[model samples]
Target chain A: MAVLTDADIEALGLTLRLATTVTVLLLLLGLPLAWWLAHTRSRWRRPITAVVALPLVLPPTVLGFYLLMLLGPDGAVGRAMAALGLAALPFTFKGLVVASMLYSLPFVVQPLQNAFEAVGNRPLEVAACLRAGPLDRFFSIALPLALPGVLTAAVLGFAHTVGEFGVVLMIGGNIPGQTRVLSMRIYDHVQAGEYHQANVLSLCLLVVSFAALLAMSLLRTRRHSRD
Target chain B: MTDSPHGLEAKLAWRSGALAFDIDLSLPAQGITALFGPSGAGKTSCLRAIAGLEQHASGRVSFGSDVWQDSSHRVFLPPHRRRIGYVFQEPSLFTHRSVVGNLDFGYRRAGRPVHLDRDGLIDRFGLRPLLERRIDNLSGGERQRVSMVQALLSDPALLLFDEPLSALDGAARSDLMGCLESLHATLKVPMVYVSHNVDEVARLADHLVLMEAGHVVAQGNLQETLTRLDLPPALGEAVGTVIDGQVVDYDAHDQLIALEFVGGRLWLPYRHESVGQRLRCRIGARDVVLTKAPQEGTSALNQLPCRIVAVADADHPSQVLVQLDAGGSTLLARITRRSWHELALSPGSAVWAQVKAVALGL
Candidate 1:
């Protein structure tokens, strides 16, 4: 009984790529959205905040069902993609990236929002008086002060995307070298009574998660001591 | 002191919750103009409006012809766009930056033709040893010094200070006051400072804008405004006289320096100031003693023959305040009810006013 096979290696590699791509995209998109959510006094703040945090409490199947309908050939997004000369997104690597991002949205956004709130407006006001424009102040003062929060958000988003299963199962549909990530592969192995293969893949995920969590705790201690 | 109106000209009307104020002011070109009032008197609001920080306010704010906020023209510049530096009540420094990094932020962002000398300012403000230190680790006074130096390095056109010393202890306040007084002497940019402290206002302000409730009670030259007799009844007890003059002579043996004003002179305890340096000192009304005749056996260093100009009721019923004219200068004397009746003190009554050497605040 082989513990690790060639298919397992490809699945883990795809999982890493998907995790990295999703985490990077979320950071870039979530930063400005989180910043706006933290500081805005507009009437839509509560509604928007609840929407962003919906993924945290909503069952992954609920999100996956809606996403599946939205990405189907006759769906609005699929129509737009076809008009742009592209294929439908379901069961593809790009589709997994998209689904993983939706699953991990709150993991990336909430930490950054909390960090931005902690930084407050006083330092920004002081920067303005010192002749820093809006964008300049954000990059120079707000970002540096919120560095610890940003690091935490990045790690959480990466780990969460790697661990997600339900949403990826619904949209990605277990396509090898495309969307058969480590989590889906482990599920397939267990269903086929390949207990040894499932155990090995499960142990790999457990180690990666443990290492990431350990790194998070160590970074938190270093930040606390510095502060 | 030219005849033309210059420096900051602001006509602002603002309301914050239940408190509201409308102030029309024109401050001078150079030197410190203090916005002095009690808390809730809109002193800080005036400073904020001038700095383009108060958005609720309407009307116009112009610093020496450069309009910062003009509601009429719909021209409202943001803080970074306007060349102004603001120092808050607390030392709101960037906690992420080191002292040197904070200084460099200002030095690099300032536009061309920077007039401030960075090295000399660093030495003057005693920030050499703390260059690499984190802002959070600095003491309150040290942080404030860094905040001020940070503002100065930006080469601002106008500097606004909103009770910068109100957060410090007595000892720290005194030390920072010394630094601020020295900085005021050399600062080329105009300043609008806000404080409720009478002593701080008297020591630092060349001009004063006094406020109460939401109104400007008085605003003019420091000496003229402090000596005005028709001040608001709420400020009756604080009525005194301010004298601005040069140190004409100093007697080291007696530790007294003779200060000459427009039409009179007074001797105060020496504090190691060189001759010919201008001094602005205040004398409380209660410190002036009026005698019918000059006493030779008195230890008081100042005795001037002044004629009674007017007598007004003081805040206390048991005392009366008398105004006197010693040639061209005006002096205030606070005396008891009994003394006023017994001496037959009236207008044109020539009397000798004795001012104690230590009673004058410099």
Candidate 2:
């Protein structure tokens, strides 16, 4: 028997695409937010940080349920989209991407924040003294110094989004070739009692997860020895 | 000294959690001005305020005619806008860049001034060979050398140094001092150097500002400031005068160099200085002994005919500080009260000041 059926191959491709889009979007959004969170002394920082970390503790179903409500036809966001003459985002690939971004926000933001904090004020001050303006200092000094954390954030975010099942199942409804990701495909095979297909899909998901984590660890060790 | 009437005029008052001080200064525009004091006396604060580093510094600061800060008018130029190069105790270089990258970091940011002699600076600081090396690969002294060259490449109007050599060891300290002296002679830019090392101040400073407990005790020519008898007790061991003497002759047979200053001639152990070259020497107060008459066949290498200018109580009761005029130059002698009374020394009394050692600064 073929290890992966055509449907399984389609699900794997969909999962990789979804993971890649969410990771890129989250990184772009996370860099600035994480930089502000690292450097700001405002009293609101604590509460904002707590809100970003909520997904880490909230069960995936709970977050997906809230997102489902917010994106449902009767919800405020859904109403705004309708007013803009846009389709609602439930049980669709676009909805899955949105859910995954929210679920993986902390995985990307926390590492970047830690990295920015580690790059103390001295280098920035030196840059300022050297006549470098604010933006130049950030891009030329602080960002380069925090590069390792950026890569680690990417790996963790991509891996975490790939492993997600509950949120994708809730918002995407497991439609073949569209919303059925690798994790949900494994679930579909088990439900149909196809042990061989289920085992093949499950092994694929496990191997991808392991490879990602091993890459992150290797990047971390390399950074440590470089320092 | 070119005596430019307007140099750096600053009246600043700064107060932080652990330290505070108020200073009013009119520094020279064309030489190294050492802000001399003990640690925590607000020397660094003064330097920072001048560089616009102290955000809370209130009062007026003007370099020549450019007003850097005026709290009343709410006119404050940020550090980046102020064309000043500042060097801290630690090199604090950008670790991500190599030495060449760091040297270029400021140079390029400063618009790569066409007048800046990049090749000469790299050659002067001996940085040509180390340009491609990583910052971490440098030794402490080499790092400071790079730091200095990095600051200079920025083409600043004024250079502010905050105890740049206090972090160096003996060998590195001398090496950096030599570099500083050479830079002083080569560059026309004014400098504000903050240091507590008396040797460094005497060797490097043309003008001196003495700070004590966040207050200015005295500010004047370097020799006059050091010769002041009324300085705080904290300046006890640092009391002395610097003199510029000409090298007259060298006795290679006996290994001695004859030096001539106003009102006297002296012989020092030879150190390969050419004749007619000016040698700078620091004679500490504690290194001199006053005698009513010169002793024949004495091992003491120097004796100068000078008159007692004044006398004051030394830091200790048993010792007295005496000021003397050697020809046209100034000298100071710290001696025992018993000797002062035995020799009957007073203003206008003629005497010979027997010197023990003369410190040569790099």
Candidate 3:
């Protein structure tokens, strides 16, 4: 029977908030882009697909290094924010969110794009003949049909964000109560030789991620059976 | 809305890869008009263009004064703004929704106040028991019926049926045709039906538009247009003439409906309909036998006095089309080489045509 301390609870809460924010942002950004990738007949599709999937192949440290520089006070993103009268974002919670979004983008986009492709053009054409506009078709036809893929993408993005350490360390800088997510907290406890606390935090994250994946798989299975 | 009484008018030109097509057509505001053509003749493409689904084209489509599309003027109304219902060959019902939910989708999206008559549509289509079931559990015919009902719920000004019966088996097709005829009779909305089946066209269409190579070669009343011998070979050897009739009597014990035509009476198998209902029956060209005088004691139930207006050779072996005028209504009799020679069939020959009555499309 392991009891969680106040600090441990805060770390779990921060982790959940970070993962949720990143997942929501990914969905908002990924949906239209995925739709375009799935439907466009342009010759540049291969190049665009390769660019979107670049983060999946590149090491996390490489992405973290570039992102850290770009978000620093003197760099491009930070300079743009300053010009807009906003605060610099490097070494902050916002910076960690940005890092997680970039790291988990493929996890969100691939499944959604595949789902959109699998829906084919026939159903959409039928919807069009039934007097459905583009947006109405998406909400009434596309989104509902692609629900399993959306669920898979959301859970994968959140789980991938939870396990992230390199990008957060590079950009978020492990500040207590601000940027120290559960994964970072676990790393700190391990470095200080606090094995029990590290084990507890690791188990919590493992249980949450595992539960999310299990729920997603179960939902998909049920949908298949119904069909 | 445009006040032009013509329900639909379109002049569309489109290029897909190397295939370029141009079509111009206008449909009257009432009755079922069929677009009859072979596959690859742009039948589905024309329907899609009218529905506002195919956008990469230059066209002028106006339905009853509403400018649907005018690419030259850069005016286009999206599909949602075009009040049309479409039923595809595949049914295409939403798999995620139950039968009731699918029907409600169209009902809700229609938005404006409409006399939907939802219960009546369900009962007419025999969909009451299947309403609560998920779409995945339905048979092919059930799915198509639900699809038709869903389309009707939208209260569309025009309905497009693109081979709605092409995917069904023979029995299902016959059953669905009855439902479609009922819907056509009750609804005031105009319909554009597409099919390559000539028998189906003869049974349902009031007007026929014949397409070949993306062009409408002929268009007129169904009986007149179909009886023409100059039609394309895609129509096959099953060409026939259509006549509208009323059920004069139904002998339930004999399992037949006695239909009253201008020339004579026709007996059809019991079709789930009451006496006095209007019905369309088709007699194929090959089913009639012409005799110089009234035949006595024959197995055929119908022998009507007819005058041979003309005789033309059919493309097939030893067959000639004998055009006849029976009580001011035009009919065609297809006879083989041996029969034509034996009867010495020619123009102005008054004859009695023997019909077996079983070959009628009731």
Best by DockQ: 1
Please give the lDDT score at residue A212 for candidate 3: 96
Q: Please, what is the TM-score per model?
A: 0.93, 0.92, 0.90
Clashes of each: 0, 0, 1
DockQ of each model vs. true complex: 0.76, 0.68, 0.55
User: Chain B of candidate 2 versus the native chain B: what TM-score?
Assistant: 0.96
**Residue-wise C-alpha lDDT for candidate 1, range B1-362, written one tens digit per residue:** 51246688888898887888888988888888889877888888778788777888999888887888899999999989888888988999988889999887867998534567898889888899999999879999999999999988888988999899999987788889889989988888888899988778888888888888877889898867777777776666566777778999999998889999976889998987779998877888889999999999998889989999988887788988888888888888889999999999899999999999898866
Every candidate's chain B TM-score = 0.92, 0.96, 0.91
Give the Å shift of residue B108 in candidate 1: 0.9
Candidate 3, residues B1-362, lDDT tens digits: the string is 11237678889999766667788888887778899988888888888888877787578999887899998899888777788888987889888789998887777777733577888889999999999999889989999999898888887889989999999987789889889877766768888999988878877787888887877878777888888867766664646768788999999898888988888787877867688888888888888878888878887877889998887778776777778898876888888978888878778888988888677645
For residues A23-138, write the lDDT of model 1, one tens digit per residue: 99999999999999989999999999999999999999889888988988888998899899998899888888888888999999999999999999889988989999999999
Q: Where is the poorest 10-residue window by lDDT in model 1 chain A?
A: A1-10
Best by TM-score: 1
Instruction: Answer with 1 or 3, whichever has the higher TM-score.
Output: 1
Model 1 chain B: ten consecutive residues of lowest lDDT: B1-10
Residue lDDT tens for model 2, A156-214: 89989989998987788888877999999888889999989999888888899899889
